[model samples]
Target: MSDERTAVRERAEAVLRRLAGDGARLRDDQWRAIEALVVDKRRVLCVQRTGWGKSAVYFVATALLRAGEPGGGTRSATEESAATGPAGAGPTVIVSPLLALMRNQVEAAARAGIRARTINSANLDEWDAITAEIHDGAVDVLLISPERLNNPEFRDTILPRLAATTGLLVVDEAHCVSDWGHDFRPDYRRLRTFLANLPAGTPVLATTATANARVTADVAEQLSTDASGRLGEDALVLRGPLDRESLRLAVLDLPNPTHRLGWLADHLDGLPGSGIIYTLTVAAAIETAEFLTARGYAVASYTGQAEDADRRAAEQDLLDNKIKALVATSALGMGFDKPDLGFVVHLGAPPSPIAYYQQVGRAGRAVEHADVLLLPGAEDEAIWRYFASLAFPPEDQVRRVLDALDPDRPMSTQALEPIVDLRRARLELMLKVLDVDGAVRRVRGGWVATGQPWVYDEARLRRVAEARTAEQRAMREYAATSTCRMRFLRECLDDPEATDCGRCDRCAGPWFEADVPAQALDAAGAFLGRPGVPVPVKKLWPTGLEAVGVPLKGRIPPAEQTLPGRAVGRLSDLGWGDRLRALLGPDAPDAEVPAELVGAVVEVLKDWAHGAEPWPRRPVGVVAVASRRRPRLVRSLAERIAAVGRLPLLGAVVPVGEEAAGGAWGNSAQRVRGLHGTLEIPSELAATVAELDGPVLLVDDLVDSGWTMAMAGRLLRQSGAPDVLPLALAVAG
Candidate 1:
């Protein structure tokens, strides 16, 4: 046994040397994991810190498994029988979470003389060829996104064959398998089915750096389950200390967004090397990147909304150290590899320490030292609440979705949007959960019911929500803790060997400057205070609107469409965002428009009047969309705009029934249906609009779905206004 172990270790080291360097060696835990996978053919769960070479273990194990050596004749009787299968018969299938991670793994595999291929949304056209290579036994590693596991074609045809022949199955970023994890994904739950289908004696490995004790146990349980859906007795778990010695952790409490922005601008260059600046929202990322660029910094904004090509370009620029930093959101997190990333700065605190650790782990991986700073804003809790609102819907919503799905025919998500109240993202998530539960199935065209009853599992969902709340509370405590910051994060992740690192702010005192330069502060304030985001015109009606009793479909008539408009700011903006949230939040009491906001509105109108693409003609009249919740605020905004622009105050478009009172909370089709016949021009207003000489300024307190603006503007145009221009105080992102 000892000699066999030595042989296995030698082979692993050789592979590691190729992947790393001539001097590379496997750590004790890495060797143990490789031994369990390649020699014992056992399932293993590895929870180690970043830069711990978890990937190295799997790559080496893949090499050893395909070579059919099994530690040079150390195989047991059962393994010897299983050896009847052809050598190098199958590729190692790695279910990864992000495209960036897949790319990194593919490149790393090549270093070990392994041929790797990926099939993701980005490489759809190449999937057929790649699958052929895998069948031909020419591919050593196959990386796929978690979402691809449920692809109708892949799941129905390709996955079963791969499961039967796969040499080793690896689940990277395995923490996502647990709903209790900070970044839980519903699609990851599909792995259970895949696991149940794998052939006997096939090795499996799950790797992650972010799971806490609860999440770790959850993931381990899933990994241990056998093909019969029963838990197995033996599964190896290798957990290591979570401390990152090279990281210098600190938290700077800024008074507001202005101070945080100013601090970044003044001190970004002083940070060790090129790195990432994380913002909580897309709007904030864009705003921060623009400000930094105007200040002569080489930076770019990266968000989920960015085009794939743009995201790739930004990532490459950052990797090459061509850009000072990439101002990004959580979209850039998870499996992004930059061994020498010098620093990571957060503009706002994440909802939990586990998530924060996962992101900061990107830095200090290869370097001797790296800086990690958190600038916790006062609005962090509000942002947390906003995200929490998108969590699993109530039982009624789930039932509605299931009821809408047909057993005999599939329904595309777009077709169901009019019938369901959930947003597209949340709805898709619900469908995935249901699919995993056997209540639904994704087909070639869309999704169909399975005629399987599914319990809501309310208790489990409640526990998950409670866990999220606790995580948020823990994050708040972390921001205020005077104890060792690194130790605190480790403990938050339930690291068994957590201890003070003696390098964080609380351990050795402040390592970052607290004060923002006066000039930078002024510049940041001015940049944030600068207003006006374009309100894009909706050119096409939402699909399947007729299903909701609205005849609208295809492109909206040009004459009925509102001109491109402007908003004073986005509700997700860094400057006026908090104030707008306060004024427009459900709990807030409505009142007349504040004078300062009116001034901001005037500034927006000024820019719109003379800016490059000015309104086709000066507005001759102003009209407000009647608001049941904020009538005073909406009317006052319209009145103020008319007074400033010297236009007549045309009466408001009135809502007719309770349907119109259904606030802007549903999908586009539902919103349009609610406002279709409900909003009409009052007789007096219609007469006034008929006499308008030029475009009418349509004013509202907020634009959420933009359906209200479109429907109201359509009504005005039908009533004889020559053109309609929308102006809103805030636009919801």
Candidate 2:
């Protein structure tokens, strides 16, 4: 190593030794990796295990790179560091996961007189100000959360300036970038975008205590590293022993929910020092906390439902040892780096091993000996199965949404919804989620489906949102298992030691496994029969499509049983003719279901038609129209029909109210056959048969309500054949 590299390395080593005590040792490989890192231009993934001094690698690298001219003499260990100047000349920006870690680092740096600042959700504006100072050469080092960095405004307005003057980018808790890691953020994918915008030759250093090969590859790809072969030596991957000898992993099988709670109470009573209890829901967290607190333990609970400040304070209280134990949902311990924790107890089983490992790993951080306890019960398993059923969306729905938009012209969400079957509100949210995952983009007002909207391919993105839901379900299964909770978790995480968590419940004690129970899989099997035939839930009971003793008579309308032709007849009888003539004017028959709704429906339909299971709970809408031929009032109505061509359906019109006078069309039923078809007419002429569109729905009240629908339908028909279904809430007498 060069003299300057050695000096930088020595300073970093001294800091580590002082912090970790004299007995701490740095691996030879770690040192060599640091040397290579100091001189490299490419980004690096320092994939080391816990207690391997991964963070030190970046600090040393940062010091060396910022030191002017590689061979410069070493300054006194206590010399005041100089402030950065201009773009491409500033201190390193370390992007981390937790605010607590940032505050701790900031405090440590302050004591040494080194300027450091932390930026997270709580202090975004302040972070912006510190970022400004970096641009102006006023700060030496800055620490921030990935969420803050992911903000586009921050990227656009603040990052470019620091990038111009920055020395290095340090990503702590880097395991989150990997699928194998316990936690993943959809926004982490943007780190690639951030790196691309930074000054060339600026080194990127990632530090995480946990990662396997796949995770390493994920990190490599995220950092935009060239993984054509394998990781570079400069990458510095220090793999420590996976075995946590001092932390005993144990599992307990509870016959029921009652036993599970009792088990938690028992464990909390005996445990000493700071501990954490992870549960599945907000209620569980609160209940468990109450139980422990009532039993005389100083306990606190946390969940997403808690206010932001409350959550932060609760976390700090845990760290400050104000509470001896914390009963919390998994939301409580992301990127928490405190090492003094004595135990981690799962009131119920964790869903996956990755999660279990992450939670259990918290206990032994500051001390050598720690313990993790798992109590699995029946309710946990039910929750898991319930959640797993939400994995995928109906295929037809996916296809419809995709087809609604032009590949060239990205339509606004509002414009697209009516054309598809999806409810206006829900489809918009899914689009937003997809946009965050990079599968789509928001341009103007609508989401433009970009790249592959891969309804089937879940592995395309590094931070796949699908896996998150899956992991969540798996967590419930893990928590509910009577088997070795650790073993089940390992299986979920795909850990090689799947059945070998030696000290777990399965390994140490008698096991009682619950047999698989019967339940209907809604998204699976052929419950709908064949296409074009609507099977209401009540009708599907004979097929054994029952869940919880009764078929859920979902939102499907009772009129769903009427044949298409009958539905059309009923609408026509309701005087929709005048309405159609008034609404369509010259083009009543052409309007298709809003273009977006068709796409949405088609997307759902295609997914269902295909094998994609577990459709997400999305809102869908269908509109039907009914009308009679009214030549006297609107002449070009025929021309409108010719322009729009055929609609999806048409049935004999039935008349109601004053429009009922026209019973003549019913006689020629053979000519047009469709049911509950939309009837277009005017409300004022309820007693008259002034005009109509054939194969109509008698929308008596709607006909009187006015010409809006009929006019729109006319315009729709005038354009071309539309899938415009019709709708009428009531048929007035």
Candidate 3:
């Protein structure tokens, strides 16, 4: 090799030694990636396996491009170029997805003598200081969350400088940039703008362990451009075989959720070093962790809903081997660096093989062998379908958002929510899509329509939807396939060099027993069978309700409210939740309460009666809400509760509205208005309530937004009942 090339290789070795250790060295592929970025100044896309040292390539490249020598340090702060800002200092800007991942990246970068700093939602207090430090060239690397790229303040004020000066731009977990990716985020597409605005010749590198061939191509197309504004084919694709030899994969088809929980409880002790217990939902993660902890396993729950401090604690506990595992959702997916993690167990299959690969990739990174088991459940598809439904809304829904937005005034998401009838999350997602398409702009106050001619990319969206459907089918096949599980995953990801390792259950036969101990099974059953989830009463009115001409705002009056309610189960609960979902989901017909659920409700009421703060008096009467969807179910439940408790059954609350109230759509305030004046107490029921000396139980089959219960209870109270206690069989969260 030429001296120039030899020197570059020597520099890469020195940098790797600083980041890793004196013994650390780069593989041929790793060196090639660094050469492309640091020497050739070319944009590169690396689609290697999880433990292929992807991060090392970027860190090594950053050291080479900025320092210009092996282990060379930074120049004095006074020498920093004021005209070009921090890019003059040649700092690497990494766009990361998860806060946990960013934290890991910062620490990893620090080990290599790389001066790394991060600006994310979790560290707002540090952003100004970090940004100033970047301006002064004190920071060598700056890490940012993808969502920050689109922030009005950041994009308007800070991004232009960072983009212009960024010496090397890195898109970590690059799969998210592609809509074809399993965990697509609309904000990630905003990276195109960041990429477009960079100064000419800024080297770029995108890295991901989870991209399928399609995702790789999609992300590549986005990264094809350099700082000079030239855009064409993928910069350079270096995809390698995706199979991990250290992972001994398997799938166990448990009979039910109870059995799955039981098997986990019985077998968890046998797993090696601390790892992750992946769950399909946050509630499931918490439930699983709670059960495991109760069963004497050392574990903690980590979900997006957790506070940053708690997530950090849980991550640290796992890293320190202080806990056996962290039961988590996809929130814990990317950028976690645990090399000796011993096992990875999934309570349910992810929606796609690509997503599954990304998550299971967390284990066996530094181990000779690690167990990767997928406990597939019947509910996996349901969860998949639920997430699929959140994709970009139909054209009509998009147009409604456009029409609601006046060019002159910006509308906050909360104000648009009650008007457009979309939930908060879906509304925000729609707004993000609109913002990207140039139909609207997000400003300091809210979103404003740009009046741009925006066409719904129907064909593209349909294709995406169809792709999700196909992926779900593939996931099911993965569970049922008798072929090598690793080969099935690789094939699903469209990896050309797929091969069977003969280390999986399908290839080598079952490595784990499918049996659960009797005691464990009983405990799992009892744990899941135990039920009672409180449905808190609605308190504050949704913001901007008056824009829709509803006068109500702030807190609801006590006299017009339902008491803090109780439900036998949440639709998302692992225990009785599955049964409740079947009974209350969109297609279920109005019917009497099931006998089994009737017993569960009785138990819930009995527990309430014997609790520390039991009802002031036994219910004197029962009142059912007139239902458009499940009248029979509501009436039957009320009758059962009244019969079992030996209370009088009063007439149901009648709906006097122009149309039936309550729906799957709409925000809290809109829901409140729809049923605000609709529910009425009949004169006969009024007289009966007036005579009652105790509170009445207002019954419903399901409590979704809680508006109907509040409205119905208000009518009972107005009709002279002393108090109203709301009860329901299921609460849809």
Candidate 4:
């Protein structure tokens, strides 16, 4: 073995020994993976799901790197290390999403003989003391949430400590950083900005059990690293089981909101090992908790509204298995790593399949039998639509908030209060709406609207529908796939694949037998380019002109007539033809044009015209916009296409740029300078992109204005590139 390999194995064995003590052992796979992560300079994007001992990767990697001769195999720590600290420091600051998860990690480190401390809302002086300890070389890991990290005091002290420290940086529940992730948080957005300002050579390792293709891209972008090989060579994705072989999947559709809590209360009375009942609202969460408690179930409610202590107690109760069930809003769980959850019941319809899968993922983590139940009714659809609608605000409303907050200026809610017309509470809700829209960032004490504002319109309906469709298709595909659920999940996750576990809910069944394709077709209506068989003329007349070459002037039916002033009139006065003419608008001269009546008047037109169906209501076409940043602009243009014209917005044309020093190059300054270089899509065009599933037209204002367009084109080609049809309003050829 190379000296580096020997060094890594030695470090892994040492960490194992420290944790288990005498005679401790490391699995060959665990030892090998940990060794690769430690020696490799590329930051790690670990894709293992929950309960797969993911934290071990970090602990083992840290030990390996620390054990090796400091400068030879590893990059030297930034000036921020002890060399930069007050002489004897070895602290590694962990910017996390939650206080509870931080505590859990701290406890785990303690079990391994590592000294770790946390600083959140509950403790301020402790944070200062921990830094002193870190500066004094007594601290090992310092855990903190993004909210706390946002404090100028925290960043001032901690970032400098981090800059000088040589240890590792870890982000758990990494999906929160992805725009595509359902549980996106504005606080998470600040993580990138913070990381960007960190010292050079600081390696980051992000972990998430649930991440889709889009989420993975966003995560890698945020970490400011190329995603090429972070997961590992021969890295087999390890997913436990989809089938809870012993558990069952049940769905309930209630007629009204009142029926849901009552139903949950009666069913969850005797469940054990802790259960989580998720609702769409805080009110529902509280009501459900109250109802369950009234029925003698040791239930507690958890939401963003709960006091820190109360929330912590509730979480601890669930962890200790003291609480039979915890009722909470969808916001309650993200970094939750509980492994023995017995039941995960959705008291309402989750907005998308990704959400449903993620929530259900909380269950069956202990490798034991567990159930994921869904309760959906007619009312549930409206309720979910209401919640989902909040994710996309009306364009005017969005513009109001955007105009109020300036990017060049330091932004906060106070600066926005005067210009914002909504009531104080309503304003908060609108901000939350923008939060889900990925248009703003929520900071420690205020809000920052990070995205460029665009007008919202009917096009949003398409974006929402497209997003919903994609998520539903993904979920249904996973649930009903014929292959191993683990393998399918790996594919769905867009990560490396391991051996098929052959034990998911779908694998154990006699094939899923789902009619997803058929359902999708029905939803989309008739095919875009095909015409039906011809019909009888008796059905054609009401609208007027028959076939194109049927000699309309001579043997003209009562429905046909060529006017003297170059205007055409329908003989039978069918209102449908008039509507068609109106839709075409005043721009095109009205001829005895039978082209517009293709679909609706198909019964009449089909009789005369032979071969080929008329193009459907909306033809799918490609529209590409040239951009240095694909993620930021592509989505916006796609939304636009889907909106103005009813075209479906397929995906994006990400032109792969050149590989450079520790990062991918040429996409955008945002991609290069910002931690996650997220491409911000205009909200107005989001719907257009969602509706189409074909080629993306490359869009931009000018090609020669700069190299951004060409560079974006190159990068798009590299990233499994979609077809790049360049479309610009103006180009300086």
Best by lDDT: 1
Per-residue lDDT of candidate 1, residues 1-733 (tens digit)? 5888887787678778878999898999999899888888889999999999999998888877776755555555344323123565378899999887888888888888778899999988998999898888778889999999999999999999888888899999999999899988988999988888888788899999999989999999999887677899667889999999999999999899999999999998899989999999999999999999999999999999998889889989999999999999999889888899999999999999999999999999999999999999888888898899889889998888898889889899888887877778878888998998899999988999999879999999999999999999999999999899999999998887989999999999997878998999999999998878898898899877887788889999998999998998987899989889889988989899999899989989988989988888999999999888899999889988898888889889888877552344467776776778888799999988998889999999899999899889999999999999999999987
Per-candidate total of colliding backbone pairs: 0, 129, 2, 49
Which segments of candidate 4 are over 4 A away from where they belong? 17-33, 64-90, 224-263, 269-272, 392-412, 422-465, 472-733
Local error of candidate 3 at residue 607 (angstroms) = 1.4
Residues 175-258 of candidate 3 have per-residue lDDT tens digits of 888888988888988888898887766788998988887898888877885445476545878888899989999999889999
Model 3 alpha-carbon drift over 4 Å, by segment? 69-89, 226-234, 658-662
Distance from true position, residue 439, model 3, in Å?
1.3
Report, for every candidate in turn, its global Cα lDDT versus the true structure: 0.88, 0.51, 0.85, 0.52
Candidate 3: deviation at residue 143, Å?
Answer: 1.1
* Model 4 residue-pair collision total: 49
Candidate 2: segments with Cα more than 4 A from true spot: 1-5, 18-25, 63-71, 80-89, 108-114, 178-182, 224-236, 386-439, 442-733
Which is the leading candidate under TM-score?
1
> What TM-score would you give candidate 3 relative to the actual structure?
0.95
Candidate 3 clashing pairs, residues 3+ apart or interchain: 87-165, 200-227
Which runs in model 1 stand beyond 4 Å of their true positions?
73-86, 659-665
lDDT of 3: 0.85
